[model samples]
Target: MKKNLFFALLLTFGAFATSFAQAVNDTVYVTINRLPVKVNPIASRDSVYAGQSVNLTVTNCIGTVNWNNGLTGGSVTINPTTTRYYVAQCTSSAGCVGAKDSVRVVFKSLISPIATSASICFNESTTLTAPSTCTGGTITWSNNSTGGSITVSPTSTTTYTYTCTYTGSGTSNASGNLTVQVKPRPLAPTLVANPASILTGASSTITASNCSGTISWTKPDGTPITTGVSGSSLTITPTATTTYLAYCTTNGCSGPSASQEITVDSPIPSVAFSAPQICQGDPITITASGCSGTYVWSSGQTTPAITVTTTLSNYTVNVLCRTTAGDSAPKKIKFKLN
Candidate 1:
């Protein structure tokens, strides 16, 4: 009985000591390492034109900083030709990495600007187009237009200007101007003709006014004059009574000017007469042919043939041909008596 009690006490003491040691070891302590905070990058301009430069900056950055471009810096200047994103990663002195922060840069431009001058005729329309290369902008015209292209018609000369506006971050605008010249259409030409009445095969002077470019003349028969097609003055001869028309042409515009009528008279007639020379104290006879009207000789004879019984010096005779058209100019015949 004494030995069993001793062994039991020893077993209880060992179990209590083991339990206490386990209890003391149950309490735990932990240490934690956290990454540093990331700083967002800032740029001088979020949007920039092509071939332009921008400045980027980062704040609250600690110890070794790594950028996407393999460069370490607090501030940098970048020239971006397109949309780009830039990131910066910073680390603390305790050798902990932080989350990366980034920024975006957009590229744009207004290039190849064109505003050409224009010329148009009166009551005509012309189209105006702004430069098509400009991006991210609204085109506005001086005439209160909001389109890239527009057509305008002006009675007189006019001037126009176009403006391009870009709205948003890094907003920008540009402008260009052009002039449009409007020319008035020429008026009808005035025509004038000399010698209202002309003899057959005779030419008349023709003149025009308020005419420009090419001038042309046409007969009443609608036949155009091929020669002397230019200038404001010309001469033409017609075999019979004819009317003429004048026209002016300029810049693909042509119209009749005025019309003139010229009267052509019939030609004079010719006569053939025979007079025989006689000696003193001899009777002389004269005959006329192709005579269509009454005739009178120098001896007061009203016949086609006249005889002079007594001629001392000279005698004169005249014959005239007349018809409904008109009277001939006149023909004279003289006979010499010896």
Candidate 2:
């Protein structure tokens, strides 16, 4: 049984060897002609400004080569706004096309755009615009603004960056930045007058302070006082109690308005004083009426009636009146001594 098993193994081995030899003889080798054409589309520059031209070249191509755009040359000039894809295919003498080869031309942006800088008043709004040359790509800003333009209300000085993306064919991105300077508003103005209250039709010199800009006045009725005014001071004669406001501006920024109220009172009183004739050694009395104020006489007296001894043939007495509103014009009286 051992001898038979050994003979069977020998037979199996012989059969495998014969089949392998037959397979090797039957195998055939075929040659596939790979296209010798190599497409290498190159641009004159990595990036070009908008409205510029670039050259595309395909090298290592033999026989007649056809480009994607029916262009039949190793090198061709092209003006592509964006990244471009070019395919080059070469044909054999039998009009048979080889394996297609392709090239991607990367276009970089030659545009160095500068964002618009703006100056605005505090709490005010302004618009920031990107250069028009960057319109071909989608614009994105560091402030999360999308598009060529955005409105900004910056509370303080801020700088923003904008980026534009060029997609398809070739992919690239460019960025630009600008600064916005926010100027503070002028200090609030203060309105004041020489006297808080005055008689009717009295002129009050209204003045403005704590201002760092030109000022204009407004009447109580909210109408602008166009009385040829261009400074921080103005005088107004109001027939009744009136309030005035001052508006100040600096560098196109406006400050809070300052206001003051003036009270108008009754007109000044018209009063006169008279002196009585008396003996040379007798005291004299002075009297006044038609006025409401503290009366002061030239005889060193402040009462309504002042008595003084006559020391000369004639004595001149002057009386002055003053009230909360103001002082009145002086009145004089003459007395003859006996």
Candidate 3:
């Protein structure tokens, strides 16, 4: 009967089909003469992603066709996470199997992407980066720019957004946002040194102003202070003239500075005598001069002048001046009276 089925198939391919039904021992047999069934080597698609389906088609099968999985159909739809083969086996009405073919459907793996970044300071820049996995798709930023990495220098706190779309096999998109914080910068301080002129060994008061916060002092008394005191006022006892500078900073940003100079002076003491005043039952007077300070006399006096009635042939007196800064080191003048 199978031999006759092959002859029947030839006749069907030539023009029309031929079928013969016969019953024997409660078993019935029929014949189907038609074109051989062939599974199309080409598929709806060569490859598909997980949960994605593809159609497998076959043509010209006699009566009906059976897939390897026992499903009966001329076409099959398959969705597999892994590679799969859908085979079609054509059977004749006589129960004789004939002609077989298969098609392969590949599954692709899924991919996801992410973005990264950091914070920044005022006048400072930072690099923002994202994955380059757009895969023939467009990548756009909040600034309406396209690319993988970008540099930004924001004056204040800011937030940026990004999006990546992939058109591979399927449409995929990744999006995220980044924020950069900005720290403020400090301002320069104004300095004022009261009593700009001081005597040697005297202290001068330097004050700071016009700053956002605490101020730092520098260059006091002609000496550089690497780490200085933090305050608005600084008192310095300088032996010589010097310049003082002040400024403030925050978030590693520096501002302009203001300075004040102090001048120091040292004065000598002297005395004025009456060119040897005659003492014949007469009085002699000596006065302190030359320096704007307290005076000391040899007669144990603190006044600037002294009087005496000695009547001695030669009377000598000495004096010195004491200022706020220091005592006079020289000019201890001596005067004689006759």
State the displacement of the C-alpha of residue 75, model 2, in Å, after optimal TM-score superposition: 12
**What CA RMSD would candidate 2 show?**
15.4
Error of 3 at 140 (Å): 5.0
Assess candidate 3 and give its TM-score to the true structure. 0.43
Candidate 2 lDDT over residue span 108-173, tens digit each = 553333434477889987777777766467899888989888888889999888887766445556
**Any residue pairs clashing in model 1, and if so which?**
none
Best by TM-score: 2
Q: What's the best-to-worst order under TM-score? A: 2, 3, 1
What is the model-wide C-alpha lDDT for candidate 3? 0.66
Model 1 TM-score relative to the real fold: 0.42
**Which clashing pairs does model 3 show?**
none
Consecutive 10-residue window with the lowest summed lDDT within model 3: 16-25
